[model samples]
Target chain A: MQAEPEGFDRVLSSMCTEPHPVAREAAERFLATNPGDPGTYPTVAELEDRAITMLGDIAGLDDPSGYVASGGTEANIQAVRIARERARTDGIESPTVVVPESGHFSFRKAADLLDVELILAPTDETHRVELDAVRERVDDATALVVGVAGSTEYGRVDPLGELGEIAHEAGALLHVDAAWGGFVLPFTDHEWTFAQAPVDTMTIDPHKMGQAAIPAGGLLVRDEALLDELAVDTPYLETTSQATLTGTRSGAGVASAVAAMDELWPGGYAAQYDRSQANADWLATRLADLGYDVVDPTLPLVAADVPTPTFEALRDEGWRISRTGTGELRVVCMPHVSRSMLESFVEDLAAVSGRTPTAVPTDD
Target chain B: MQAEPEGFDRVLSSMCTEPHPVAREAAERFLATNPGDPGTYPTVAELEDRAITMLGDIAGLDDPSGYVASGGTEANIQAVRIARERARTDGIESPTVVVPESGHFSFRKAADLLDVELILAPTDETHRVELDAVRERVDDATALVVGVAGSTEYGRVDPLGELGEIAHEAGALLHVDAAWGGFVLPFTDHEWTFAQAPVDTMTIDPHKMGQAAIPAGGLLVRDEALLDELAVDTPYLETTSQATLTGTRSGAGVASAVAAMDELWPGGYAAQYDRSQANADWLATRLADLGYDVVDPTLPLVAADVPTPTFEALRDEGWRISRTGTGELRVVCMPHVSRSMLESFVEDLAAVSGRTPTAVPTDD
Candidate 1:
């Protein structure tokens, strides 16, 4: 009964990425295919193959083993599953994973699902993992050390190279949770890919940053054996072996990610990233000028210190915003977040903050 | 660069269900929506709410708590997670899940991911879980008992009401894997839902029988607290609690499922189900008359005893037939499997079985 949904044109606190025009069509094109049963749909299977390769190249890997999953949670779960399987092979019982508090809640779900002990380490004031704290948590039972790139709260990139070295020295796997940063970091000087460290696995959400449709997360591993560790023989399927967390994944997601990469590779995404960063920077500057404390965004996210009442007030006034770990108003300037929208938001923020409303001349 | 994809006009041997026309359009309309992160898109979240309600009602649930997930694997995983959590709360350190050999592979994935022991119960000749074997497997450590509503190989439904009694008596939860049967069982006389048993949870795939687009599976729990038991606090987002296996789920999936239910709820689906049964009966009768051994189909599915060479030959001829566990040729007569397709398939099968091809007068 509902009509076509318009994109989130007015959403500013949106890590919920929108599909690019071409990627949206790509999703429609392959909606009927399931890559999990590849034999029935060779075209979609080949598209998935191409998409994974393009993502590996973007992740700075020569050759990587991976699959297009539902989202970051599935990928993160798979990454930790591989780590636990490998750890078990080396006679490690009661596997534990140490993740910073800034890590995505998917890690918590994974720990709960995988029956592993989750050691949540404390973060610094900036919400970056304290390496010393992580070090204290790592032990012989530690199977994985999770580092976040583009921490959801502040858009802070963790020291992955340092964590990788620490994990390797402790005979543990280093997994970079870069679901929100993978597509943009390639355009920046930041190196969160395999080239920067001996990272065992990484969770990259094409849905989040590649501007693909929902359910296009990738789990890229350094070795194919990492994936094989989860592979189980399926006597019924023509594929003979199953490795993914899902049995019947939407091939449309894989096709859309491929189209997204084809349309917005490193260069195209660089331009888009520039636009997002500029918008974020502009919003931060305006908020700072309004006397509200703001964390300078690392990517396209900004967290402004605002009281709970003011935050609730802005939302009540129809401004879409979330809060940070410290209850600060958070805004993610995605491509959908326009300058006019940001300006209007600041006007509302000024009103809620009880500061002299930054008087932008009203058109009315 | 790919153009609009054609629907499965030529696909047969496809157990993979196609979305209803209306639901397909619904998915396209809400392609940009993300119900998981609902701050940006509230309409899609509302659609998800309605879809879960309709699904619960269809499953004979009074008030069910659930989420639209990627597929049956994710739903099955979450169901197992809830069972494990409840078991752990009851002081069972190591949990075990008893599933019949006929259970879908997702149970295997769930067991592997959740660090639980999977005890495979033996099935009778008809592929129904033997209650005696299940009894042998259920202990204090048994957290869950899995009963398949529709076996993947055969269209056989297990005795869920009986299993439910055993599970409840043993202080274990009963979970029905109705990924393929949720939409059909209600239309039939099968008592596989809550109406028949004290079923704690069920995995139903809207993508499969509901005829929604890909990646619309749901895990419906008996109570809200059962869902809350798995929900962890995600402080950054406006929604404080998170329970799904995915974070940023495909809003399109939720939309499509809602649309599917809206378009085909009960009365409308009965007509479709009737057509499917007729088609299946036609195929089974023709095969039986042709001296081919066939299992009596319970739903819109047929399994015929065919040799390995015949199976390969059928695939070589572009007939999309699969094999049952007993090495029988399997065909799920979905909406796309037309009468002409079945007649052509039977003709080929006759030739493959070294019998004279059925003679039919050509239109010409």
Candidate 2:
């Protein structure tokens, strides 16, 4: 049977990409181990710690307290659970979380699961959370104020520092969903990490842009004590308690996260960000020249107002693309997305739209 | 860096075992694909459906509706979420789940996360859930009644048929957590599957006894309508809604599950179960001859009332064993466990207990 597509060739608009060779090897070597039972698999457990330390370094935390989660959804859910539990301890009934309208949909899942009221504060024209709206939503029952760092739709980073201040003022914690942006945001001037804000929790996925294998999502808390809210007593195991959402999880993600971070931390990731950002800019310029409305390429993500017919035609031509909620064609410039691929996609777009292709200047 | 403990040697307590060779290769091949976005990765998505179909066959559900979950914890959590949502629709505000005392700890995590009350029913002398206790605890508030098929502690299968009747009478759904038993129980004379019982949902892990890679837990429902309760709108993706708990999950698990199931279904799993059961029986006899109180080998799991000092001493001797909640030493005879390995473990037990080793007749 045809197991896989031809090596992520026509894949775009996906946060995941091809795993690094080191990460693939690491995942294979540790595939059989279970980090859930740390006592049984001490090797992978150590790797998970190292992966967290590297994530801490990237997210600007001195000491990180978290585990490698299934993905951004699990990480985000755990963050909300922590906030809700803390609020319950404070005798707050019907705890609520104020989140940006541009936040990931996992927040809605968390709200439904944890019985928290989700207050969606509108985002500004730039797609960042409106600080005033967040301030207005905070109340005694508010447990958390969430900010999106590298949002899924527009790749916008909210003003996390200001959001943290507002949340703390209202006696609520701040959580940043940096699932997609955490890897590249360090090279930029975005103040979205623990060092930059009073961020109680953060969801940064290694599988997204960290070049680790799939399922390497990171959830870092400012203090280890914050994890106590999510801990459940684990019986018949060596560990006393488990804070993760899933039990008997694979060690592949942990080992791969460590391997990928070790192979491509500051220098390699910086170079990748530069190339990807340049590709996004190139694609955005090409689309704009074609008279299409485009969102600014904030973090290697381009959303253009391509017509539905043109979009469908391009898709029929074998270009894997998706449309946002607002009907704008979205394209994420992941690591596998090269200049040639973008050029081909633009050519296909021009062909489908019956527009002349523009000669965009290329750095490479 | 010592990546792995020398190939599952001395590891006698964990439910996870080494992945089948075909499963490892399949996982590596689909390491980067995300089954979460089925529209983007159709190849792996098809494999996921095939995996579910195979899981349905094993679980005795002819037309199963389910997804490959991260692990048993996620599957169990999703099942609870479904029950809670359905109960909410039925106007039950404070939903409770009646789980056996021998149930996996994930139920507690599910209770804390899903805002559902957890009611732990006592177990009988054979380690199975007490039917009378379950009947007494289940009321209008009970949304779900959980039965353990191959429990974590003693590998005891609860009376799922009777539990289903009780749950249905109370207007509750019955969920079977067969995460470690689904593969082997198909070969046993246990009335624990969907065909045998009125099981509304089931948690069966391919990573456990299925010999697939980790993070390959299966969640199967009796009907497709049950998944609607867990559905959440997913924007900017090929699919409009997502029922899975985590987003952007790895396709490795799905591919590996299909590969493993295809490689070892009826005949292979039957042979393995026979061998593992024989091994458990052999170990139980050896321990009983040494004057140790042993729980019968109900399902390839042996629990002996070894003294705390002896258990600690055996652990110090590098035997990776664990104690159940009642302080009995527990050993699971997984697929990786062999006759020689059990013999060696018995030898170590005798050495630590200062007793003469008894020669047990071996089938091999």
Model 2 chain B worst lDDT window (10 residues): B355-364
Candidate 2: which docking quality band? medium
Q: Which runs in model 2 stand beyond 4 Å of their true positions?
A: A357-364, B1-6, B357-364
Off by over 4 Å in 1: A3-7, A357-364, B3-7, B357-364
TM-score of chain A of each: 0.95, 0.97
What is residue B284's positional error in candidate 2, in angstroms?
A: 0.7
Tens-place lDDT digits, model 1, residues B1-364: 6644435644555556677888889888888787887766788888888888998999999877888888888888888888999999999999999999988777888888888999999999877889999999999899999998887888778888889888988788999889888888888888887867788899988998789999898888888888987888787778888888788788778888998899889887787788888988998899777766788888988888767877788788776566765678788888777888888888887776665424441211
Q: Which candidate leads in lDDT?
A: 2
* Best-fitting candidate, scored by TM-score: 2
Residue lDDT tens for model 1, A63-123: 8789898889889988889989999999998999999998888898888778789999998
In candidate 2, list every pair of residues with a backbone clash: none
